[model samples]
Structures are given as C-alpha cells and as structure tokens.
Target chain A: MDAATPQLRVKRLRAVLQSVRPFSSPKIELEQYHTAADLAARILLLAQSHGDVAGRTVVDLGCGTAMLAIAARACGAGVVIGVDTDADALADAASNLRALEMEDGVDLVHSEVGSFCRSVAKRPRPAGVHTVITNPPFGTRTAGADVAFLEAAAALQPQVIYSLHKTSTRAFLLGRAEEMGYHAEAVAEMAFPLPKAYAFHRKSEGSVAVDLLRLTREPPAAATAAAAAAAGE
Target chain B: MRLVTQNLLTCQVKACMDTAATPDGGFLSYPLKVVPDAGGLKQVASPFDEGVAKSILPRLDWAALRKTAAELGVAALPEEVPAGAESDAGFLRSVYALVFDIHLEEGNLLCPHCGRAYPVRKGVPNMLLRDDEM
Candidate 1:
C-alpha cells in the first residue's frame, strides 16, 4: 500500500469507531467515558507522523470498547493490546472487533492497567512496546486515577505514549512525566464533548478543554554522560 | 489467540517465578506451549505487509518464535533470521504465516516456568490470575 492508503483506511476506521456505543455503567465512579472517534484518529495520526506507531506494537490502557485499539490496528499496528478492567466493556469491545473484522489484530485483555503493564513488562521483546495511546479517566470521579494510568504506561517503557487529559492539568501531568524520566509535551488541545450520563451532570451536553500529550522516555543517564564526555563537557 | 499474540506473552504471575517453586525460577515464562484442543487450529488470510513485518522483526523474540514453531510442527522458520530476511519475499511470507495466519482458537498456554495454565477460549487468552496468585 502507498503512503496515503493507511491514512485513508484510518479515516474510514474512525467512522466505524464512532458508531461503537459508549459504556452504560450506572456508577460515575467507574469513569467509563468513551473517547470521541475523531479525537482518537487525530491523536493516532499525530503519533504516526512522529514514527511512534505504524507496524509497532500498540497498547491501549483502560480501553473501553477498544476504540483507540481498533484504530491502531486499522492504521497497520503489528499488534494491539486493549486492557480494561470491566468485563462488560471488554465484551462490547470484542463484539465491536468482530464487527470490524479486526479480531485478528487486536487482543482485549480483561485486566486493570497496573496488572496489564506488569504482564507486558515481563514479556521478552527486544524492542519493547512502540506506543501506548489511552484516554484514561479525567480523575473527576476518582482522584489520581489518571496518574495511576500514566504511571502504569510509563512502567511499560514504550517508545512513546499518547495520553489524553483535561487541559487544566497539563502542567501537573507534564511535571509528573518529568519526574518519571519522560519528556512530555502537549501536542494538541481540543474541546472534549461530555454527554450527560449521570444525575450530577448539570448540562445535557458540554465540552471541556482537553490536551493530548506526547511523552517519550528521557535518555539514560549513562548515555547522556557518554555523549557529554565525548564532547569534552 | 494468534501465534503473534503468544509471541509477546510471558507468565507474569508472582508464584510463576518464585524460586522456591521451581529450580530455574526468576526467569520470565516464555514460549508458552500451546496444547491445542480438538478444533483449536484455524487459518485466516491476512494482508501481507512486508514493511510491517520488517519493522516487527527487530522487536520479535526470534529464538522464541523458532521454538514455538518447532512445537507447532512448522518447520519453515529457521533458527536464526536469515541474512537480508527483510527483502526475501519467501522468507517474509513464511514469517507472515508464522505470525499472522495461524490461530489458536481453543487451547491452554502452559507456562514452561511454573507449569501454570492459561486457558484460551474463543481466541482470547485469560491471563488473569487468581487472588492468591497475585
């Protein structure tokens, strides 16, 4: 396929992803909000441009119904792993994968982010994971949930991670990424639509400013030191 | 689950690597032997993308793939990735079959380390551990 072929495929896949239904969990504490398909496609395209994806192993943390996971596969990911704690969401994801004929490329694992990361870390892959794209809970319902996801994704040591978070917390998240030995930058910001799903929601439909972060692990101290020594620093 | 997926899995349960449990413990479980069910094996045609395969070659555990292929009675894969394997059309086709075409629809992935079994049903591997195992 030509260079533009994957881009066109991703466009079609994004439409299919938009058709997948969001989780209907009654508890807001679950933070089971679905990522808008257009936003996911944009993040994926950006990741592709940076050579963080395309034919690389991609992991989707807290993958609800496998929207990002499916998108990654459609864009030619070598392998896509979707980790989720909710069985119902995984079931839905499985159905969606079948519908899209993407069951072959994607694996939906029913597990929390932490355990999934640990399991993947134990795996013996020389190149390790290529990218992790996740839209974790915004931490509105549960405190520190987004951080937990970030911590887990960092633990996997992917080449890069593309994560979505509320724009207000961009500074704090970047600081945390720095502490974890990752160079993070907000690559894009957009209005994230939040449909009313709970009694506490004041508006039927509201949009919140959200940022897409691209995080890459910092060079090891030894490598940096060697480079500096070569330069006679 | 496809062999490509299995190629990336390792037994992560703590007890599975407990030195007290086995002699050669502490090492991650690899090449989890597949015990195929009566109708476990299936074949599906996948788009042959040489570029994707080339990109994945560096990341793949070549030794593990060789071992798994041996166990599965696939003799096409060589012990070592051939020189210029990336551009070799025949070798790339073989690699594609080993990675993408074959599927284990129903089976148990028996960890060589702790002898723990992870069941595969409807092509999904249940990697979740019990409470005590965690």
Candidate 2:
C-alpha cells in the first residue's frame, strides 16, 4: 500500500473513520463509518472460508469508510470497490485509504446499494470478484438496505456475501434472503461492540451484538473454474 | 431500541414477572432517563423493571422499535441521519433512546413465546408467570 491520494486533504469524512479512531467523536463533521478489527476479522474469515482475499475483486455495499475494504485487501483482495450513498463517507474512506496508501487496494463508489448492484451486474464476467462484502444499515425505518445489497451481489454472481447486521435483525434478513431464493449457509453471531459507535447502555442492562455476518452461496461451478484458472487450482 | 419503543417494550420485573404479556391481561412498566455520552447528552428509557429491558431489548425489531415509540403519531424520520436527531446518534444511541429514555410506565410487551398478558404497576412490569404456565 502506497499513497494513492494527496496528503493534507482536510474534509469531513463519514463512518469509515470510526474504524480509524474509536471512542472519540470525529473532528470533521460527517457520519462515521468505522469497522472494528473484530468485525473485519469476520469478513476475513468469510473470505478465507471461500478462498483468498488478496487478489479477488470485492464489492462492499454500504461500505461506510472502506474499513472492510482495507481489511479485505490486507487479507488478499486484489481490488475492493467500496459503495455507499454518502459521498462524504466515501470521500472520507478514500482519504483514509489514501492516507494509509490503501487507495490501490480499494475504490470508493458513490451510489445507492441498489444502483451499484445494477451497475455491477452490467459489467463483464470474470471481473475477479468471487465475494461481496458489506455492512448495510439495519434500522427498519429504512427497509431493504441489506436486501438490496444482497440482490446486487447476487447479480454479480459472487460466490459469497459477508454483510454486517445486528443479531436482532436475523428474522428479517434471513426471511428476505429465503424469499429472494438466496441460500444462507450459516449465521455467525456473538456479542461485540461496533468501534467508534456509542450505543448507550443502561447500567441495568447488558448488551451484545453480532458485528459481522457471512451469507454465501456455494461457489458456482463456474466460480470454481474461474478461480482454478486464475490460481491454477 | 428507540426511547419511544423502550417505553412500550419494558416489563415490570419485581413482581416476579416476565417482560412480555398478552393483550388481554398484560401491562408494562418502565422508567426512563436521559444523560450525557461521549458525543452528546443522551436519553435512555428502559422498562422500569430490570427484567424487562434485558429480556426484550435484545429481541426488538428495529422497525417496530420506531413504530411502537412513535405511536403518538410523530413524523417519519428523515432519510439521512439528521444532525441533532435521534437516529443520527448511531445504533447504540438510537437503541439507548428507544430502550432507556422512553418510559414503559404504562405499557405491556407482547411475549413472542406465549400470548398471555402481563400488567404494569408503578412503572414496573409484572412478568411473573402463573404456576400452570411455568
């Protein structure tokens, strides 16, 4: 990883920042999209289970600041596209990546998850992505964020999709996945705090969360073929 | 959980009660308070009953959390997390508002397991199960 963007670029960034700095408010005004190493580890595990991350193309939906993108590349993703509706979050993510010289490792795309999925669907096959990783919003007021991303990743025909969501959202997410004819092979859950995220907990209450989730389809015979061709597997 | 939702979902625990109850005989009791956090002052309302927030908060659906809290006919939240708004405060913040700030002083949490009713008294939900049900 080398400097991909200019240094000294001062601007508001979004959620990806929380990953860089947790337990502190972002100095710049913008939403924080930070991923914890704990969450990133889950994404990496998904990639490891499927194959490798270093050279594969990964589409990150609701990719708040490319935290997973950076992690994926570090693990082995060849090219990581971080997609989000927030330009500021994307810009911030880009800046963070640039600062870390991870620009070559990832690309930040400004678009809604739905539109991004459609665009990816239009691209040529064998684009080097066998996986789609994302951390979409789980607030029900905004329904379908995860579903839309999953549909989009499905369009890309990836072998697996690793999305982050609250454990409480399992019913909706799993229900929607089944309704859409998508297969969910497993759900890995645990109690974890999302970094840089201040979830007020009552002294009287205990809280737990599943910061990461991996929803993958079996590698298409085609994917195995492609990967085998690429790696001489 | 949203404060608004917390007000409704909390069960009265001291009565040796369960958090959720059926519509016929169930009631909820919660006490709410708002305080400061790293980012800003926060509001957390939980079921006055200790047993309530613990049992139900983990199970709350994010959407219903909004609907139950905003039962007073509040406006729909903005598309993006607006500054100074509840939703913008991140997931935990939102959950705090839903679970901690809003008082379940007079509500009942519907049990996902049984359709029986639990009642609230003095901002506490009586989630105690009957001998037969237990």
Model 1 segments more than 4 A misplaced: A1-13, A24-27, A124-127, A218-233, B18-28
Error of 2 at A228 (Å): 23
- TM-score, cand. 2 vs. native: 0.47
Clashing residue pairs in candidate 1 are: none
Report the lDDT tens digits of candidate 2 across residue range B1-134: 22432232322222323443345543332221222122332333332433332333333344444544455332343334335443232543444434445433344444333334444322323343344543
Q: lDDT of candidate 2 vs native?
A: 0.47
Which candidate's DockQ is highest? 1
Each model's DockQ?
0.44, 0.01
Q: Per-candidate TM vs. native?
A: 0.86, 0.47
Model 1 CAPRI quality? acceptable
TM-score (C-alpha, index-matched) for candidate 1: 0.86
RMSD of each: 6.4, 19.6
